[model samples]
Target chain A: MAHHVRTDYGDSDPLFPSKAAVFWYAVLIAGLIAAPYLLESYYLSQLVFIMIYAIVGVALNILSGQAGQVSIGHAAFLAIGAYFTAVAQKYGLPLVLYLPLAGVFTGIAGYLVGLPALRLHGIYLAIATLAFAFIVEEIIARWESVTNGNEGLMLPPPSLFGLKLGTEGFYYLCLLVTVLVVLAAINIIRSSTGRSFMALRDSETAARSMGIDTARYKTTAFALSAGITGIAGALYAHKMSFISPEMFSLSVSIDFVMIIIIGGLVSLRGAVFGAIFMIMADPLLIILKDQLPLWADMVTHGLYLPDSVNQAVQAGVSRVVNAPGLKSLIFGIIIIVFIIYEPLGLDGRWQRVKAYFKQFPLARQRSARPPRMFLKSERR
Target chain B: MLDFTQQLISGVALGCVYGLIALGFVLIYKATEVVNFAQGEIMMLGAFMSVTFITTLGLNYWLSFLLCVIAMAILGAIMERLVLRPILGYPQFSIVMATIGLGLVIRALVGIIWGTDDLRIETPFTDGVFKIGALVIAWDALSIIVATILLCAALYAFFRFTRVGIAMQATSQNMLAAYYMGIPVKRMFSLIWSLSAMVACAAGILLAPITLIHANLGFLGIKAFPAAVLGGFGSIPGAVAGGITIGIVESLSGFYLPEGFKDVAAYVVLLAVLLWKPQGLFGLNAVKKV
Candidate 1:
């Protein structure tokens, strides 16, 4: 569509040839390397979580944004990875070997799920994936012998070469893996397979006409997506130091979806920004909940309001602000709002902001280009 | 033999409840091509509203049910006009995500208003049980079966005789053709949504007596999804048949098999159906034109 237009120089290239782009990368890498030492343990842990989510989001971007397949049951792959890692560790496998094993196993499972997905269309694929997630949860809960049922399984801290990896060590491990995943994702998107995926996503008929084996590419995309998500899951399990089927519920799957959408529809940069936004949103909501009442009091000062009216206002504000569901309610509302207003998500908005600066002298009332419609078939 | 018959009766009753919900799924999918993920939440809201009307407001059960159905219709209409109408031409995923967002909003709203308590509504036939030969059935289950038959007949007659109903049928088949023939297609969407919401409410009211009227009850919508898919995604009759089949299978498996087989049995049946006949038992297989 219109949004996919290449206005910037070297827009289609995988490598950043511009000095400015390389400089930004250097700054970002240096910041990441110094983050653990500069930030507190809690903030470092949050960064680790963001990195994990970014890895999964990038993988999902490959399948959904590039490949045109959507999955609402991605948490299943995460669950599989977590459980397989836990079980494999118990069987005396080292952390190094079991983690990759979890990825491979999850990839195989993803391939199998993709087989049925091959025949299914949009809504049907969504339903099947949803069902697959539920079935996986059921198995985890009931197969007590293997999954330890609803009681959940406790995981030991991972060790490499007989040295126990604590929170700081784990953060490094996660960061390293995330960087590798990002590199792989960039390379994959530049490959022929990635082109086939984009073609299928844009138009199945056109992709088929071009002699692309749509079925094989679709399944392969799923396998790769699940494999990366599985790696994230394994890292997540080690990071949390505790695991349960409850951890990978449907909401978790929905959270991954919000990541890609909020980050940006089809851009890798969008995935990173989306993950960072998703992780930071929780504390942001809490901060708002706490500050809204103070702000309300400040706004309504100097009025000798009746006690009953004051009480009512205060109680109502507190209820609205403090409800547990408010976080999710706001998230749900944001998803709808973004889909309607900003289909390009945070990345799209950022691009507009950059364009504004570039065209500052001649900027008009309707300066930013109208967002391209997300649907390819409906594109003008 | 007695146990088998008892399970069969109960399964039929549960199947009827599922069928009621499945009818709503089929209706929305037929008209909009978007599966309203918030359907279960809609059903749950109906039950909660009926409970408030009956207990908190001190109204008769029938009156409370009627008021709840009307409220649900309005809610459905409002949802369509406000949330769904804006992104009409977008891909199916957009609509589906919007409905999911709606479901989240509805669920949280219900939790805030009603509290998460497991409140039970008292129905007229709460303690009644009928014994016929070697089989015994609860009055709640029996009423559900009766309600299903009556509702199905009413829907059948509505489609066959009513002008709006016929227009809805035509709209589902081909929206452009119906518009050319002078049907108000957009209004038909609101009507279809209201009708679907009303059907979901009926299912909720029927089920409230048998289960706890809590926030988690919206999960039944997910269970009923397999039923709709089993019969065929598009066909009304298929949804009913699929619902009944899933209900019986779940009932029997829960009793005869291991502790948790009941939960996954519906999905297993669904996978089998998808593998063998993806269109469902009654759905027409669509041919792709390239």
Candidate 2:
């Protein structure tokens, strides 16, 4: 007990721990930069969509994950950013100039929402944001003078000093912006402000006791989060070349929340992971739906499958594949499953797997970390 | 004057239906401390079930209505036991998300089972109208009122007089104490869910003839949130009052305001109320434990 001990915790300090990690990370970045050249146009487009959603997902993570504030109306901000940029572009502002301006404009709107949100918490906050989203949608549809009403508005391809960017050029632009936003978010989450946010998330009273100004920080988080999402919206609108209120519905807001939850709540990296998962989810479901019948047929090949069984299987497969709300149904089930069983999400599972491999020689079969259990509220 | 009276009647009738749905929210929220986001979808499915039972299955209207209620109650019990019970101690946000997801799944399932197209369910009382002085109220509207009043009275009597009802109230008030007192707290929650679903089923049946059965009918649940909020989220009587208030407001606004204001009028009222008084008008201000 009295002997001198040498303890080393230096290995956990930085993101890139060793030279190998740095080199591999560099290689990854290089690959991303060169992706458009290697991949087909369709795949590249999917990547662009991923980057756009990733930006929104990261922004949402700041509010919901880091700050413990839930919003189901994030699409309203996206709509604002899209419409703001669209409107500005109509008045001759180039995409380059209007994009940042959209963020600022959306930030102001978020701040206004945050002001009222200060009075609310949890479920009340959620309902208020939802109502706000509905109101925004109504305004967008009814206020035809500005939004062009339900017919929606179209924009010219994004240009910089009269140079129009093609699909590949736009992909690089989205990639570059997403990278910058990611870097900025990492920086923000590491700063004192970020810690304060986490503190507020864990316990408002405790954070207050620590002399953190909960009110100012909460609204600032909202402003910053909304601003980033606004930028994503601007990118989305430009990418689509057309925008409508219908595109950003309550479901989109729910999708953002799902992204953070599935990505691993309270982790920056999880945001990106979630974006990739979300972007690819619909296609994955389609593939699954298509394959189910093939699998079923294979299983029943050696046996005498009745006409009724065949008809039933066909009907079920068609429902899965072609049902109008199949995507939503799948998304809902995923949310429920993830929240109940795998609350730590994919990112959490990834960490555990990594730890298991790293500790392989001396590792015990059982995980040291206990599964997250439901925390009954202590309040009487 | 006649137009005004007529709007008032329709508004009252609509508000009662909303109140009925709002009551579902109140009941579940009171017992479980979780809002059933699928309340509207439950209503939509109930309407679809009744329509199928009557039109497709060739059952009498009354029998179909009764069967639909039973089915919905069973559905509610299954949902509470299977889906919601596992994550009882999770944060409120996760539970809310689960409910939202549940709503989506239910809506989608309803669409797959019953085609996406809207279907009219004709009831015995759809063709008639009653003239009371200057007001020419449709029989359907009057029936909605009658059904809602009967439901409210039944709920009140059940809560006040029945042992099971008192046990449910006790459970909501203090789960631990109720558990200690030999009450099955979990069973109470299951019963509350079923009861709430049954009321919503009744609302759906009454609402079917007027609105027609459609998947989009679930959106009515969203509007009813304001009614629940306006009434004080926890109080059943407050829910009814809030529903009436919202109904009157929506009716009057639709008549007087610019088009589209009617859809969002309840939210405006709700926001104003939340801003001024965080606790709903009838909701008791819960003291925070420091």
Candidate 3:
């Protein structure tokens, strides 16, 4: 095995890290671009959703992961963006105009919400965001004349530059936007702005002492995060073609938080990984539901149990599988298990695996273990 | 004036339920600094358990209530030991997420076992109504208020007079000092969970008659957040006061404000309160030291 050892500072300064990394990035992007041809419409649509959710996950990572601000209500931003597009479509606005406007409107909403966040910290801020989400949902429902109330709004097929986008075109569009957003995120993370956000996360008092404008940066984080999420929401609305207040409820907000946490906090790759996991998990579960009974029967065939007992067992399993809340139940369990066992998330696990391979025979068992965390008193 | 008084009584009764739920939140937060987002789910479970004891098993109402409370207390203790104990030292965000997960799990399990249909529990006071002047109040609402008052009194007595309660208080005040003083701090945590769970069960049973028992009943816990926060996160009395204030505001808004404002009244007040006084009405401000 050969290592690309950096002899000069400039060798390690580029975004790709090494020639091999650049090659891998090229291959990944090529594969993604070729996906529409390789997969059916159903799978292609799923990929579009994965890309869209990845945008939200990346945006949330900027706030919660880099800035250490917990938001249990990011779905509010998504709702605002989606509604912006929906309402804009009603007024006969073009995709080019409404799409960016969606982000701008949602960014303003984020700025308004972030105002109270200056005085609030930790759980208080979380609660404030929660309240804000509820208020937004209520406003959407009650302000029926504009939002269509509970009836929801219908979106026309999206087009760009007077050209109608088919399913494949939409996928490519999402791919293009996702690539741009990821690149922008990378630049932000490497820049002074990202460094200041990280400083604020580590400690506000320290960041303030270091002359970082904590308030301005905090609001900046909220606006930037909300704006990115808004863009994703605009795409999402066009994809779904219809939107309702019920679609952007509290659970959606929780899902965004789950994405970043389960993907791995503080790592950009984690956001993409988390989005993939979240988007794919639904189809995976459905597949499991279909195959589970056969698998159960095969394993139990050797037992030769009574027909009645076997039927009862199969019925029980089917009932559990068919339960409406099973998906959320499994998601809840996964979150708990991850929080307890793998707080660093899927990205952390990947990093450890990479490190273990890099060290090979030299790797110690304890080397990959996370540091023990002590109980930090919330009391001042 | 008549309609206003009627709404006020109903609000107070609804607020008492919120207070009891908020009490559960405050108890767990005070002892462990973990916000149990599943408190409402626990209350839902309590309601379902009572329904099983009363309607399914044909037990007397009072007997079933006692049994439900005891069962929920054990469940709470077990929950703390199993899920919360291992993650004690993690950041507050992880714990909050875990509790939210717990809530989702509980809701699902209840859906699996009981099915998702709404359930009704018959109480002795379900049909009775009290007529005073031009106002008519249902016995269900009145009983909720009375039960809440009694429960609060009992809890006050327990904390003020009992050795275990004092120990729990000590643990909440300063966990390290309490451990140094030979108090079984871990046990105190388990006890606090059980105590809060017991209170939650009582609230659930009281509330079931009014709201109807359903899996989504736990979402009421969201409303209780405003109550708990308004009262101050850790203050027992504050939780109740906050709950009542939210309840009154909600009821009044439902009547006086435009449609749909009632649903978000608690949250609106919560945002306002958070903006005005982040420390809460009863919470003492603490400056962080770097």
Candidate 4:
């Protein structure tokens, strides 16, 4: 009932100094260590947020990518985790105890939600989960009894073994937690449970006929997915030092999908890649918003655009030019383009590029075969 | 008693907008097998266009309304052709994501163009209020009821008597079979999409007089989704019934029950309906070929 764990390590040579692998590892490792030092604390904080999202996104990949389920209301589970941590911390629960308790709270909620998911598959299950997301969000927004409604509750600083952890400590906590989560996810996918999830994904009918407890496995997958995602939410709230319903909106749920899709949904490396890319985009786009107009003037007026079209093009430049909304428009277009051209997502393309380099000499000897296999694999 | 009647009437009127939007949801779902979550955003954008027609372009409310419906219809056609058609053979999950993404893009664009502030829709028909037997009823609630009944009747007539409507229904029923039978299924989808957007715009126009026109007005569309589900996803009549039921139930619940529960009443009904009968109130039962 297990998946081919060797799928990940199939092409990965342990001995050979593959040029692309070395370059990617070197870049990623250096960037990860250097990021906190190179960027301002505010930017580092943004990166921390991105990493938290990456953790949730990767966690969700288990249910979505591996289990073949579409969940649009992931933020509800996120809120449960965040609010659990916030409440526990508020009521004087110790950090170590509260964190695990937060995970348990969300895990049970996920399991409960997944119960209905047993009967419904695909789109219907997605909508039910989405509805649940809405329910939770509204409760958080309106339930003044516990949640503090729209205003949200404040969280006290986390303490462990008599040390008050500040923002820097929280950032490091998020980073360490995310790395550990990614490593755990990678290991899980290599384990039997991960294979069963994939088996469910490939064909639930086959998986069922093969004596897999389809209902139990599906629900368990969701619970497991929620466990990791909820922890990410807890970490996110702890980092922000506050918990609000607005933080876990429908849009935030979509952002997780964007990260997973762009990162190549099925890859373990995608968790890190997605975090760094999205983290960079977080600040880079803000800088580019101003620089784009200037850069446009410089590049278009001085260099690329024809004299006739340049003025017209500059005039039609949209209303939300200053806000992050324009970047959103571009991001939407990029996603559409990505879905159409590179549906395997960025990691899929990265794999192709890696394979091209890794197998350059031998594959160059028979280049036509690789391209054919590529076209076939990408058809879905 | 007056408060009760006023709330009931107003709730029913607002429910009609949900019904109309739900109608579009059912139509699109029937034709393309896609539950467009972006339909509300489409309605919001339509309202903005209608506002632009009346306020900016200096037209009468009736003329502006008709013109905006046509414009919305055209936009819908373009969307069906440009955005949706390209992704036709892809999985339903991706299609849902794509439309949700499109909704975001549209919402952002609308916000940028119209600013975040709410706009007043000065429909002259909404200028008066009347009282009946100790009940105060606004012109808005009355107009919405009349407009919706008229629209539903007209839609029924169009679908029943028209060739394109029958072809559309046939296409929705069996795409490959309809194609084999010489039906223009592709054109039918475009027509359905345009008609769907037109219906959503109708709701927007109806909704605008009662409420302010803004980016946030689209939130009603989310509420209407449960209405569609509570009815059959495939049944036109069921959509209307579902909307009215939700509206009345929500109004009553908000009045009698605890506060936040009203927000979830539609879903409560949905969950109940799903548990009892998943195909919805009017949906045809399907026996899957194992």
Candidate 5:
């Protein structure tokens, strides 16, 4: 095996490893930009949703993946952001003013949540956030004076300056925001603050000993994560044109967590991949629901079983497929399977595949496998 | 004052149910160090199981309850073995997520099997109310409180006197140490899961009379978090105390406080408790060693 040698520090330090990488990214961006022209409005809207979810995944990755603070209630922050946008719009605030304000306000909320979080660790922190989420949901429902209570809030079409955004225009807006957010996330991860977060996540005591102000960084991570998620929420509010407390339920929070996990944690690209998967899973499931029963009948038709048995099998398949909870069941199964088998998520899998192709015939099977991890007991 | 007394009684009953569910959480957390987010779902399954045995199978009420508890115990053991055993030493976060997934799966399964409608479990004590001096207490409430006390006492004795119980205690204290001492740490984990599931089933059966049986009943497990945390996550007695306190606070708040406070009372208390004492009421704070 030959190792490629770098001639200078700049060669090794470049953001894009090679000209090919830069070209690929350029092509990817170009494809994204061209997507609206080729795709239907429905798919364009879905792309907007993907970008929004990607923003949230990135936000959560900053807090959870980088900082090692597990939050089971991030939807609360999203709720804050959406409601902020809704209320700000109600006051005739411009998009530019309210979008940043939504992030800032949600960041403030994150800071408040983080104060209590400073003391809590591991599962306790997760539960506190969970409790915080429940409280936020309740407040949204009961404080109808501003939130409009259970009736929910409706918004006028989001406008930039005085111009209202159509599907394509909004897509561009979301695309611009998504690109900025992703770039900002990458920069944060590369910067000293991001390094400190990693240090804190790896070992808070060690980080503290090394003069990293653990408290400040932890809170900062929370604020940054929540702020980005809030931005996503703002876009989400605009995209939907209506907001409700139910929209930001515990399930949505779980979905955000699922994105980072499925997309692969601790990587910006992973967040995007996870967002795509999360967004796509719903329609995929719907398609599967329709096709599964027919396929079941098809397979059983060839078997030449008795008519009664065939009918019974068909009925069972249809019932399971038609069940309202089928989506959750599939999601639940996927989450469990991923945790057990693919803990590194899709990004990890992608890395392995890339490594395999790079190595070609000489690629060792062991090199592609996830490294075995010992159980690190969290008894304390 | 009489009204207050009646509310208190019902609150205690409600708290006992919470305590029982929290006890399931504490038991699993104590032994396996894995917080079973699906414990409430287990309770829901238990309730649904009993409902099926009674309404579908036409079993006697007590007989169905017994069968349901037994079945849930077996299911819990199976779950621990199949799902949890592989990821025993993983990070708390992964385990938490897995359990949350398991919860979704269980709730969804229940929905598929039982349909999404609310279900009623016709218990022997469903109708009667105990009246004393203008105070009315439903028999179901009284049964819940009584059953909880009895269950706690039984659990106390089991932990104190039984060989398996002592082994479980040892294992919880130090798995490696217990293993070296010839305790079957793996079996103990299975047993703890089964025990926790049984407790959850009992709580579910008791709660079904009041809350009705629904796939979403597993959400009550969320409320049990405060109870478990308030008692400190690992302490059994603390779970009960924290649960009772939350229940009473919730009950009283619903009666006196403005609309919407009741729903959030448990969480408010939880946040306050977490802030005031992160170690919880009965929990011993362990200083981390580098």
Candidate 6:
């Protein structure tokens, strides 16, 4: 019925409703609501993880997408937030009261960090932030009394309104928080503060010349981004029921960057796309792994593979397939291809496609400049 | 007092390793104005390569060390041509993001090959501790410092005396003018990468024994990054000075300060220094043209 109804659909006919787009969103919302009810506890937990990651994606977008601040050490802020929450919980502060407080502390750290970073632009700032990240991890590892060092301290399930928020309950919590966050972010980006950030992003010197306080705003941008990221971190710690330095590594930081790039860097829609892309990519890759043939079998059992790689590949394929590194190698190749060719990323490509469809009925895309003959009589 | 001297000697020796890595970063920045963050990963590879050749393939340590430098130089050169050249003259952010991608790819490659093994190499130098009344210093420490001085001297001569080296310097000074003089700017760019990679390899080969070689040895990349900033991003001499300062400061702090203060003390120094002197000790303040 849908295929028949959508046979003549194109961008030119705005009056004609696209059932596919409508149905996709409708199905997404329905599935999201029903996920906990339908799936087992394990799958529900994964979804909760995805939601937390989405929050991270949103926070990072505030810095990179909106403010042109390239931070690769955001995971440190997460660690700060998580540890703060843990400490708060351990010290008998109510979980709900302490979570937002953790974000405030993280924001303060971000602002302080940003102050130094602002003095040194771009690459220099990145190096400083990277140092901050390493230093944070080292402290977390060394401070046994507080962080319990590498062994990690555990947190009981967060209780909100006298009901313990288990994984299924956390899903609802994450869901509610995610909606509020998404709406808040949308509003913020539409507000004056967001515009100032975008302006600063596009051109700092020009923005300043036009009377924008680039310094104050840059720090504020960090505060806003870090504060949100901190909140997500606090939430994430409770969601996992455990926290460790290994969970927040340089690799995870890169994961956020990769997500932003694949989805879109400069678009709001990109955040959604990025979060979905990252969350879905792992399982999709796993499924793809299960579908491979000859070469896969040999590589899976290659004698050269170390214990970890062997175990991971064996687990992912289960029935004997390709090496774990092979999947990563494929992912690497794709990133290489994207960085080389479509540096603007998938969103940019999507815009061009939409433009092409918009011009289809006319058989030519309209432009201000006309044919060669018309150019000669421009003055007349 | 004896422990203090030993700590100082050990810090300086370890710092020489950071200095060498810092030298690589400065070289890359000098030539192309791009910092190769994957430098630590490259250092990691160099150490792993030396390990693989010496331990696995029955090669002498000295021979493997020399070959690793040459191999890293080639890798660096290839990286410039392949990954970096394509993104030439883009915005700093784009170039940065691209290099990070390159770094990830390189890390993954290293992991695939080595499989995250913590490795060890037989110390090529004699293990002896020298004592002067109250002060004690390991032979490796003194040797590493001496070796660094000799290496720095050789590099100095290369840049000062050789044609390509002078061309590289000129290119670093002003790419357009160098091109005008028929310098072949592209060659200089690749030459910078090759030189930086060699420097990183040398650092890795020297420091592998002391640090206990591992894939995570790359973490020092970030640590040494502060050395670059501290020395001033564009100054070669600054790299050495910054590294030694950090090393001594780190060691002394760990001893003097209460538990956990030493870890962040380096960054605190970095922040303080950056706040006080944004151009760094050796770095020239960038003149903003209005």
What TM-scores does chain A show, candidate by candidate in order? Answer: 0.93, 0.93, 0.95, 0.84, 0.97, 0.78
Q: Residue B241 in candidate 4 has what lDDT?
A: 86
Candidate 5, residues A170-203: lDDT per residue as tens digits?
9999999999998898888877898899999998
**Model 2 misplaced stretches (Cα beyond 4 Å):** A1-21, A361-372, A378-380
Could you give me the TM-score of model 1 versus the true structure? 0.95
Better candidate by TM-score, 4 or 6: 4
Every candidate's chain B TM-score: 0.98, 0.98, 0.99, 0.97, 0.98, 0.96
Provide the overall lDDT of each model, using Cα atoms, as 2-decimal numbers: 0.87, 0.87, 0.92, 0.78, 0.91, 0.77
- Backbone clashes in model 5, listed as residue pairs: A144-A149, B231-B238
The TM-score obtained by model 2 is 0.95
Which structure is stronger by lDDT: 2 or 4? 2
If scored against the real structure, what TM-score would every candidate get? 0.95, 0.95, 0.97, 0.89, 0.98, 0.85
lDDT of 4 at A299: 68
Each model's backbone clash number: 0, 0, 0, 1, 2, 0
Error of 1 at B86 (Å): 1.0
- Please give, as one word, the docking class of candidate 6: acceptable
Best by lDDT: 3
lDDT of 4 at A368: 30
Please give the DockQ score of every candidate, comma-separated: 0.46, 0.61, 0.80, 0.29, 0.74, 0.28
Reference contacts preserved by each model? 0.39, 0.56, 0.76, 0.21, 0.70, 0.24
Per-residue lDDT over B1-290 for candidate 5, one digit per residue giving the tens place of the 0 to 100 score? 98798888888889998999999999999888899999999999999998899888889989888998999999999999988888878778888899999999999999999999988978888998998879899999999988988999999999999999999999888888899999999999999999999999999999989988988899889998999999998888889988899889989999989989998999999999999999899998885655
lDDT string for model 6 (A197-276, tens) is 88988777778888998899889888877887888888888977799888887767767777677767766566666777
